[model samples]
Target chain A: MMRRKLKVAVFKFASCSGCQLQILNMEDELLTLTDAVEFTYFLEASRATAPGPYDVTFIEGSISTPEQEELVRRVREESRILVAMGACATAGGIQALRNWLRLDDVKRAVYPNPEWVKALEHSKPVAEVVKVDYELRGCPVSKERLLSFIKQVLVGRKPYLRREALCMDCRRKGNVCVMVAKGIPCLGPVVQEGCGAICPTFGRGCYGCFGPSIDARPEALASRLREIGMKDRDVARLFKGFTGWSEKFRKVIDELEGGAR
Target chain B: MVSGGIYSGKFGELRKLFNALRLRGYRVIAPKLEDSVIRLKEVTSFDEVPYGWEDIQAPGKYSVREGGKHFRHGPDAPKRILYPPRLELFRLRPDWSVEYPKERFPPTALFAIKPCDLASISVMDRVQGGIGDPYYLALRKKLIIIVENCVEPGATCFCSTMGTGPEARDGFDIAYTRLDDDLVVFRPGSDLGVELLSELNIEPATDEVLRKYYDALKNASLKAKAPFELERLPDELELGLNSPVFKEVAERCFGCAGCNMVCPTCFCFDVIDEPELDGGAVRVRVWDGCFSYTYAEVAGGNFRKDLWARYRHWVLHKFAYWVRQFGVFGCVGCGRCITWCPAGIDLRETIKSVVEWVRSRGGS
Candidate 1:
């Protein structure tokens, strides 16, 4: 008896396409992955789209427009299990920085006729429109982690994803602490792990591309940054970068600003 | 029998020791600067060790400057070589049979290690050896630990407070202190160290050279301030749990687990299974820490969900609970955690906060 291959779909909304590019970057493991699953609706890879209820759907990017909002809802209805991939689908990505500015102003800056553009007032993660079964987070999802998630899903087991700070990975790699050793302001403490602490290992601070971890204490980290000579405005700006619209970072920035009064 | 007395080992004898160890079929592992950070790596020659280069480390600041006589302990400990970041436990074959990985402990000599790290090895010996962990036991059997007595302790060192350093009293094969370019003193702790010293044909130190070496050790001790008042620490820490101090420190904690990973005595791990296409699996153990959200998590609930609670647990386990569990302080006061922490949250300050809290509550 032959086992039926799992039907999978990859969708993109509003993003830099880096997350989808990561899937293509799986050149070595792509054949192995294809053996287990049928990529039914991956537009970036194949022109012929297969329409159906997919066993699993990997969604990249955020719901930034009315059409995207409708598309995500339909994808959710069609997919049995929907996994949000990368920062955009998980926490709105760098585009979420627009949430801090007036939508009309941003639209006018980008387009000649602001009213002509069909866009939502604010970019939102997939979870805002539909429930996400699991999330693989990073600027672009880590290749190893993404593969692990797929493996687990295939075996009908829950994927093991660590909800810890980037500092954990940095320490595991035995990289000298950039913030502590170099006096560089790093966001490793507040940012979620999965980038393998790449920035810190390279002597730069983490920019929180994975968003906040479980119960991330950005306020505490913020105060420490101030103690280490980071200006309050800069500290606030730090929390407002990629994945800034997420609850933890948004609340942290709000609290820091509130404390200024 | 090895007698424990200081002997004069010439400054140029290090290259000889490296060659001697290599000749004896032992790979020498020593500290070397990589990407401006000192790391423990396998070395074939004495030049590989970062001699005459000391790191200037402070709270959230470190720099490797040239022309310093002290060879400080970098963040890498000997445990990394022995325990390793990842260890394969076993492999599950397609036939449903399990195959245990073969023990591959190499004949190795860990050179120029610190006294605090030597103390950590003893603790690990008790923990892993007592439990009969084959991986650790095999590695332990093959290791020839050669430590350096602290002539100039780092800015973050507090080994004097922990009573674990400035000079290694035991557990190492050979312990030596560099006095200057002209003089070096060696003390043998084991029969192997004595044999190595004799094979190198090292000359005995005069009382005058020994006095200078001891004076350097004393000077290193005076430089570090050991903040822990160990006698009242357990009681104070227990009561201070409800105090506001834990929250104060937790406020600065990014939950990075840097302290846990760098600390010589920390021994926690997580095991995972990677399944293959043929229904086979490779089981592996990776380092883990309490700072991770999943560390205390279980079905439907997490115990130490709050960052402050987790922070308090780490401190208490090191100072209070460890004595009850292992009869040894978990922290060797190496200050690796303080130096490696991104936020520069010093454990000394946190302990002081606990002391202050204790004082506020009628001086426990």
Candidate 2:
């Protein structure tokens, strides 16, 4: 097997920069990662940034502003492969919850001068702006999975990312089903796997930080949650967590919030 | 059918069997209370077993309280230990040859396992073994089963309807039935079980005590409620393939395959050749099921593209297809699928719905 010399870049939009920090958090893998690819533009780790047309680019955060919308489109053209890294980049993160509110009302509640707020109508994923080659889903992308994705890319293999629901991983870990044992409503069954059942392992329902699974049925889960004593708004709020702006979840949130205060 | 002489022991004597198995180099996997639920995990000593703990199971509810029978558990199936959720079939070598994993399975004893779970392994033998699944067969060979009679069946359990539970008839080395009178009837069904029985140093149960144990077993079998029988289930499912009940069920089904993951006899898997970080590609098979979005996907497209089709396929496989494929119903009726479903879609109700739909159409 032959190894190819690859240059990598990192970009960020509107986010807490946690996903960008995850690259730096790879303390042990950084050595092997350094050996695998040249860091051309990882602003979080290095000060000296290189020019574009990079081999691979990891763009973190969501497109929340017009400037970010244009920037993401530019980043997509400048890279051989553009990978959306984290919930904000892939499904608009927790900040995207602002999508549910009326634009004027939301602006009035948050800012003193509502007219000066230059945010987009909705905080959208990078895919909504430009084409994304790959997506690493989570609130602040899993460092382990990101490392494997990079390694697989270096080997010219399509990385096998698990698209199964969080409940499957939860069951595999032998964590007793929290929703069944307790009456707590969980979004695990509709949420995609990647976080390794972090919330359910800690005896809490999943907040769906990793976004919807491929076979997400929010309507099914929302109805079941209602049976277990959650109001429509409560169930809607659960789906409206991190990845509420995603298509599958957005429709359900719309239907659920209908007459659901 | 090996009805060996029954012996009586106190509630404390089960530890001796746990110890005897450990002395024989077997890891004892038993029911232990952890994280507010009973887990079928490996226990080094008998103290880890959740004694006097009773599990409450409903369509979507599962919780444990300390008051009743100790040999009860929920959701966590024994199929996981035999045919693990994720198994590496082989590694693809450089020359396009394959290298099987050089892993060894330790001889393990499943102590105090309910009879329905034990029957599931028997179903797996016919399914996996008939299909020549080496991993399950090898793991099955290394297993030592110690069956425990389930006297206090959970609300979701209908093993009596499945006719696989409340008593262990065969395929187990040792069987223990705890009576309400604080005595346990121990029976050895194999040579190894008889040797382990010798460690107890207890006399054979008298005729009176044996009769009492038999009566208790019979009474316990009657304790479980049977919602329906398996005799007409296969036909009903097949005849009602277009049943509206399936679409109705799908409306509430998450199609997450949580039911399939916890299903004891579910043997479907997806094989993928993944490139290792070390440059070698390994072929691994993880637990996949009909409910999966890509489970039925082929080159052109997916077969069960709709959730209704997937849900119908899952129910039909257990009730209808397995009977045709393996000459046995895939469902042992342990009700893990019923209990663990996040959406609370009761399989028993789904079956009933299908039956009603079929009958309403005059198809069955």
For residues A1-261, could you state the per-residue lDDT of candidate 2 as single tens digits?
556668999998999999989899989868766776888988888899889889999999999999999888888889998999999999998988887777788899988999998989988999998999888999889987888788778778777787878887787776777888887778898998888888888889999888999868888888888887888888888888889888898888889888431
Tens digits of per-residue lDDT for model 2, B1-364: 2236888888767878888889989988888888778888899989888877788888878888887765475677888888887888888775667888886688889998999999998998898878888888888888899999887788878788898988888889999988854688889988888888877856688898888887877877786655677777798789988888889989998877889888998887888776655566777888888788877777776777888998888889899998998899999988888888878788888888788878887887
Question: For residues B208-290, what per-residue lDDT tens digits would candidate 1 score against the true structure?
Answer: 98789878888888876666667878878898878898987787777878788888878888888887655577888878888
Taking all chains together, each candidate's TM-score versus the true structure is 0.95, 0.94
Cα miss at A248, model 1 (Å)? Answer: 1.3
Kindly give the stretch of ten consecutive residues in candidate 1 chain B with the minimal lDDT sum: B1-10
- As a TM-score, model 2 comes out at 0.94
What DockQ, on C-alphas, does every prediction get?
Answer: 0.63, 0.66
Chain A, model 1: TM = 0.96
Instruction: Looking at model 2, give its docking quality level.
Output: medium
The CA lDDT at A116 in model 2 is: 95
